[model samples]
Target: MIASLSKISSYKSMNPIITLSPAILGALVVLQAGLNRKVASQWGLSAALLLNAVVLLIVALLIFALVLVKADWFSNTIRPSIDFKTFSIWFLLPGIIGCILVFGGPWAIAKWGAAQTFILLMSGQLLASLIWDLKVEGIAVSYVRLLGIGFTWIGVILACKWK
Candidate 1:
């Protein structure tokens, strides 16, 4: 599987602000909406509901910057000069950490109780995608959109789960 991931200079183009930003924004809204709608009560009124805006905003900015740079880099450059093996390792570190949070954090850390578990899973995936500047296979770095539906569904589930 690792060898199969031998990446090519595949061009990635997507809307920097539109594609990835919405995912982040939507997630923020989810957290906020969860609070407003009393769906995040399982988590808490203070920590889970209205407190994460600044943190999420910073994350959004980071995702925005990463997507923008990646889009431009792939666009202006002929091909990626990065070594797949080494670069994969770099990517894997964070990705694996994210995976751990998604899979293990629920049963382990117990963030805001288990009622908000769906949020844990979906938000983690969204964060992972955002952090990696998630993109599909065929964009020359001009497309900017993510799985809005996925985020919405998770948000809905969480909204339901709220106390």
Candidate 2:
């Protein structure tokens, strides 16, 4: 992967939209958290979460509609021959966790300020990603990775100043 990336001749030739997509998404997450926090203040956490999910559903439907306009929509949609029966109960975990995040993000921001909340969130993500790399990807945890994890936790501690 590294070799493939390095072979890209020039920065100008790279796809800026794809390269910056993650940063764009990251900014949206923070913006969404703040908006959700405001909504929770006006209504309540559950109501705000419901609104968030409803808006997401509506947006997704709109996107699907746009995509459906294409002549090959049916073929594209049916191209994926997923075996539902093969999926375990674990498949539902992402939705459940997403609900938890939608519910918890605003609550956490309201309690701990966005910076602290995000710091903790990043720390959790790092740990979870490391475990995923190890167990699922069969990647070995090097000392440098351990050091980075340690620094992350230390930064979280300093940022949060837990009571």
C-alpha root-mean-square deviation, candidate 2: 3.6
- Looking at model 2, residue 86 earns an lDDT score of 96
lDDT of each: 0.50, 0.85
Of the candidates shown, which would achieve the greatest lDDT relative to the real structure?
2
Which tens-of-lDDT digit does each residue in 30-141 have in candidate 2?
8888999999999999999999889989997777776666536666663444688899999889888989988988889889889998888899889998999999999888
Model 1 error, position 142 (Å): 9.7
| Worst 10-residue lDDT window, candidate 2 | 71-80
Question: What are the per-residue Cα lDDT tens digits for candidate 1 across 39-92?
Answer: 234655344323344565688788667767677655545434567666554676
**Model 2, residue pairs in steric clash:** none
Clashes of each: 18, 0
Error of 1 at 103 (Å): 8.8
Estimate candidate 2's alpha-carbon lDDT, on a 0 to 1 scale.
0.85
Instruction: After superposing candidate 1 on the true structure, give the runs of residues whose Cα lies further than 4 Å from its correct spot.
Output: 1-109, 130-161
**Per-residue error (Å), model 1, residue 4:** 24
